[model samples]
Target: MTQTPPTVAEAIRDAALRLAETSDTARLDAEVLMAHARGVTRSELLLRHMRDPAPKGFAALVARRAASEPVAYITGTQEFFGLPFAVGPGVLIPRGDSETLVEAALAAAPQARRVLDCGTGSGALLLAVLANRPQAQGLGIDRSPAALAMAAANARALGLDARAAMRLADWHAPGWSAGLGRFDLVLANPPYVEDAAELAPSVRAYEPAGALFSGPEGLDDYRVLVPQIAGLLEPGGTALVEIGHRQAGAVCAIGAAAGLSCVVHRDLGGRDRVVAFSVTNELAA
Candidate 1:
């Protein structure tokens, strides 16, 4: 006899079990992937659709997750600062930790009329800031055409295109920041993962390596950025840089050497996640 197909709830339970070996948040992964497959929000699925028949191709999604693909990549979207951004293969998925950078920027320069975001994957940082500071005009630069395209598209989708623009430029390239002029605020969440640091299979295999790994100590990009920050900022402008929790001391040192003082900010988890910089004083973090 043919077995009955699983209901949405049953399918999620089984998918969670199948994914448990590969994912720490397997149940959450299953629910999110299923909600996407069903074209509903996870909350909607939980509140109203659990007993409904599973959507077609849910098993396929589960299989992808079972192989360790990121849920955001499969859904082609991720939320940052309450804004939905399109993300996939070449784009770095926006993380919550980076929100700390946004909050710090907003608090530091609420009237920032000009903003710049380096390595602005998907335009989440620049655009999210513009979304809040409506008077701000923002520019996001990236070396990858794919990332620039995604950032541009996200800007348009969010109706921030008028104020947010994407450019193809590498911060590490000589004279990369030229013609960009100065901004009232600058943001960067550059690659900070040490070359030898261990990462999950999903990240190593799928995420863009250019956006994840820095040199030996993961200070490569910071070395480039912190020095130029003073020039990028309008005299009193502020620069907010995201850092790996452990890199605060080292990153603050880099800022100090550049004659820029730093103020460290902690994420909800109380880990150092962002540092505010200005050329006025010694490192304070």
Candidate 2:
């Protein structure tokens, strides 16, 4: 006699147990993956848990998760600032920590009509800001064409394509900012992980390295980008860039050297996550 397949509830429970060995949020990960495999929402999965059986590929997804793959990468999507963004191997998955940069941007330049995102990974920062400020137009620059393609695809998915543009530009290259024009706001979440820093296995193994590691000190990109802020910003323009929790003082110093006033913003966890800068004090005045 053939054996009966496991119910959705059973599958999720087993998956969660297996994932617990590697994931901190095993149950949450199981629920999310199960919901995705069933082509339903988490709520729907909960309602149908005992009634339906696991989908065909549910076990495969669980195995992938058990191996420490990020649930967002496994699901190919991540939610940020109340928006869903497409994510995959080449792009950095959007994290809640980065939302601090988005919030800082909107609060610092509420009237900004033009914005720029320098290392636009998934276009999360630029797109989130544009979504909130419907009157704003924004541009995202990245050295990786794959990342740019992902960002552009996200712009189209969110219906912000007309107002958001992605381009190929490397921050370290001379004149990388040329022809981009001045913007009322600038945002960047440049690579800031120190080369030798220890990272979670999931992050170090799956996320794109070029998007994570800056240099031996992890401030190399900030050194190049912060100084260029003055040249990219309008007279009273503002910039909000994400930094490692310990990078506040060093990054602020770099901004100060460029004649930009810098202020650090902490994330919900009370870690310094964003450094807001302005070319002039007029905005404060």
Candidate 3:
């Protein structure tokens, strides 16, 4: 005899319980995965859970979670800076901490006519900044073609493609920085996780390591990025960067060494997460 499938309520509860056992995301992971499989929102799924059965696909999603895949990877999208962007294995998932970087960018870019986002990832920062500055045009640069494609899709989805462009160029690649030219604003949330060996299992085991750590101290990206940015920004232009909480002091010094007057910005958690700076000489002029 065939067994009966569980109702949506039963499935969600079971998934939540199982996910809670293996991941810190817990109930949220369960809800997001179930909603993705059912082609519904988390709230919509919960509202009808009592009346609905777990779709077959949703059961499979639960199985995947049991094996430890990130729910955002399963859902193919994530919300960041009040916007939804496409995401999956190749692209780094957007994180709320990065919003501090976006907010800093917007505040500094109020009068920006041209902006640039380095290491665009899923294009989260670039798109979020463009949404706030209708008069500003922006370019997003990434080393990965796949990442650029996702960024472009996000821009088009938000009806901001006319003002945003994407390109594939490694920040460390020779001649890459020179070709991009000057901008009134620059933003980057480069990898700054200092202790890769001590990362949470959910992160070290699942998220892309290349997107999480840079150099031994996790300060290599900043070291390479700040000096290049100094020459790239137009006079008086600002740059916003996301850095690790503990490494804010070192990151700021690197920016200062590169000629930027830096100020570290803290996240809602009161941890230093972003740093904003501009060329001191220009401001002094």
Of 2 and 3, the candidate ahead on TM-score is: 2
Write the number of the candidate with greater lDDT, choosing between 1 and 3. Answer: 1
lDDT tens digits, residue span 6-96, model 3: 8777887888888777777777787888788788888888787646777888778877877777777878889998899988777889999
Candidate 3 achieves a global lDDT of 0.84
- Whose lDDT is greatest here? 1
For candidate 1, the TM-score is 0.97
List ranges where model 3 is wrong by over 4 Å: 1-3, 282-285
TM-score for all models, in order of appearance: 0.97, 0.97, 0.94
lDDT of 2: 0.92
Model 2 over residues 110-172: C-alpha lDDT tens digits? Answer: 899999999898999999999999999999999999999999999999999999999999989
The per-prediction CA RMSD against the true structure, in angstroms, equals 2.2, 1.8, 1.8
lDDT score of residue 162 within candidate 1: 93
